[model samples]
Target: MKDNFYLGVDVGSVSTNLVLIDEEKRVVASIYERTRGEPIAAVQRSLILLKEQMDRPFRVSGVGTTGSARTLSGVIVGADVVRNEITSHAVAALDLVPEARTIIEIGGQDSKIIILREGVVVDFAMNTVCAAGTGSFLDHQAQRLGIPIEEFGDIAMKAEKGAQIAGRCTVFAESDMIHKQQVGYPLEEIVYGLCEALVRNYLNNLAKGKDILPPVVFQGGVAANKGIRRAFEEALKCEVIVPDYFNVMGAIGAAILAKEKTKRTGKTNFKGFEAAEMNFSTSSFICQGCSNNCEIVKMKLEGETVAHWGGRCGRWEIGEVERIAKEQVLS
Candidate 1:
């Protein structure tokens, strides 16, 4: 009997993650690669890598895409379901921790907080304007301190007390770190201090007006940092849980969603593994129809337009002919 799997792809600004889940909702294969500003290439490379990692042959019965580039990725992979990062993260968190009341996710470029009550999302907030509370900022600090990002948490764990650092903005944080170094603060103390600062910033920005209940799960690239986890626990006065597969939770959530969607339809739109070999391209143009001037993005496969997105009114989603006709009627 052939093994069946569901494929999920999450292409974000900083990373592209892919996860393959079996019918039992267990992760079979996963890939995490940097997007490096080219999401199409990253997704293709991730797909190829995931295929090579699997020892046995498997059939992908469903495909889902999520993250910042969900629409573009869906067009490339022929996804059965396309969702946003919020929905994908919430689903994955609920799957892992059914009683999870709060989810704190800090990715490479942004951070988000989700509040759930009885398995339903009640409220959510995201901080995209600031990088001080995100993983990329931590990575930059690690590099500045001549420390490997992988060892950051362990080093921070050695500090008995962290130094105070400003967390309102990345610029201020970096300046504070430099000043601390100049003043002869211990490296570990400074590192942990930065972690605490980021936690404070997250709470102040995203978790400010909401009720952050217990069973708080922290999942994202930043969750790998033990220092940040400790900081959050100290601030919230509760234990924070980090799932084993924190980095790829978005992709896992996407896969789970794909499975659910395909089960109802009894079919899939997966383009098969061969999709990795296909040539995909994207182009964008500013719409002149309205004051919003929404930048419309068009995705092309094999030199043919396959999808259109990134508009305030979703006018481009209806295809070129219909969009033109609608505009004419409106005029």
Candidate 2:
């Protein structure tokens, strides 16, 4: 049987997730892969994996993308919907908790807070400058101590103490972790302390000056860590809810956007599952368009530029024939 599907791609700094949602919004097939400094390669690998999972051949009806690298990805896949991380995350949270007021998202490289009222994003904040409270930071410390990252949470759950570690910056936290380790502190104690430190940093940095209330949903890859979840519960002094599809919430949110956009426009821009079989190439160039000097990225098919993006000032977005004409005249 032929099927219509939507493609939702989230190109985060640490991972890339591709999700296929059927007309009914059920996730038919999903692929998750590490970005590992090569987003194109990661997406290609995810496509290959996704290509092998489908029972029937299908085509994309619409495609939406989000995350730190959304524009680059949207162009690569010929996406129909392109939006920011905050919008994408908010959309997903609203779908899960119809009346959710607060969103706490902590991933590998960054964290974000979204406040919603009546399903609309009223305020949002992102923490991209620090690493002390991110998943990768926790992973690195866990590895240094010869402990599995997954076990870090289990140990924290058993912690009898939650000492305050320097949480203002990553460097200070690292030295504090070493000192605690050398002092023969219990692994569980250190783990819980680290969790507490991260949560403290997060609230102070991202949730500052915001009325963070209950009916809160925490989503992101870090949402899987029970220690972080517990830390949030304690810090907020309120119940924090984690959605069922916590890790894939961004992709889920993108898929939901695709579904809604397609419904409204009565059309989709999806390129089918067969797109998985095609050979695609990607490259990047810097645009000297002012001090920003945006690094415009391009996705190629054969030799033609299928997509070009990455200019913060929109100096490199493709498909704008008029803009290109203006460029020619200006030059």
Candidate 3:
């Protein structure tokens, strides 16, 4: 008999990650790929790779989607469960460290802090308006310094002292870094300084009023950076645990949710691996039916509308008007 597995996908502006787990909750495979502004293509590529990597006969019993593009990914993959990044990240953290009280999740375009009390989310804050404290900002700096981002941490570790860099905004930080370089500041000092600045900015912004407790888990693409991890440990004055699969924790959490949902429902809505070959398209249009003029996003499969959202009211939903028109015509 083929084994049953659960699939989870996390789609964000920076990256897309997919993970497969068995009924025992052990990870079978995990794949991470850059999204590069095309979430649909990214997801399709992930699914194709996942299908090809199945070494043994298995059936995908359930599917889950999470991250910034969770809704769109869920629609494309026929997810059995859909969840937000914070919820998913917290779930993964609690699984890894049941005593975890705080979760620091910094992604590509944004960062978030989740406070948990007794394994339940009590409060959360997200920094989406600024890019200064995100992976993208670090990548930008790496490019400017002509250094590979993968080597950023190791280089920072070599610094004897970190130079001060403004962390209030991306522009200011860039300006400060350029000035530091012009003054003959060592590359390591500048790099570590940027890491400290980013950590400070994250705390000052997202963790403003919250009481951050220990047993904190830092899981995200940024968590892979040793410099950022060291900065967090220094600032927090405590150890910050980074999961083995830090970069894909959101997807792991989503897979866990899908497993639980499937257990409860006794069935899954998974569209199957064949979905990778299907023609999917998404478009947006302004709904003029109301003063809101909401820009609604619609998803189509083979030229047929399947799902749509983005309106305050349900007036622009995919089936609302179509269903009513069919009823009127029949009557």
Query: Which predicted model would earn the best lDDT?
Result: 1
Which regions in candidate 1 have their CA more than 4 angstroms from the true location?
286-294, 312-315, 319-331
Stronger candidate by lDDT (1 vs 3) = 1
Writing each residue's lDDT as its tens digit, candidate 1 over 1-331 gives 7899999999999999999999998998999999999998999999999999999988999999999888788878888888889989999999989999999999999899999999999999988567778998899999999999999999989999899999888888999999999999999999999999999989998889899999999999999999999999999999999998999999999999999978888999888888899988889999998999999988888999888877878678754334433643775
Q: Which model, 1 or 2, shows the larger TM-score?
A: 1
Most accurate candidate by TM-score: 3
Residue pairs with backbone atoms closer than 3 Å in model 2 (clashes): 59-272, 60-272
Q: lDDT by residue for model 2 over 136-215, one digit each (tens)?
A: 77887788778888788888899876867887877788899899888888878888898899899888888889999779
Alpha-carbon lDDT, every model? 0.91, 0.81, 0.90
The RMSD (Cα, Å) of candidate 1 is: 4.7
Model 3 over residues 1-331: C-alpha lDDT tens digits?
9998999999998999999988877889998999999999899999999888888889889999998888888888988788878888988889889989999999899899999999999999998578889998999999999999999999998987788999888889999999999999999999999999999999998899998999989999999999999899999999999999999999999999899878877998888877888999989999898898899998899999989888888675644334533653775
Query: What TM-score does each of the candidates earn?
Result: 0.92, 0.88, 0.93
lDDT of model 1, residue 50: 96
Native-to-model Cα distance after best TM-score fit, residue 28 in candidate 3, in Å: 1.1
Instruction: State the displacement of the C-alpha of residue 309, model 1, in Å, after optimal TM-score superposition.
Output: 2.3
Tell me the deviation in Å of residue 103 in model 1: 0.5
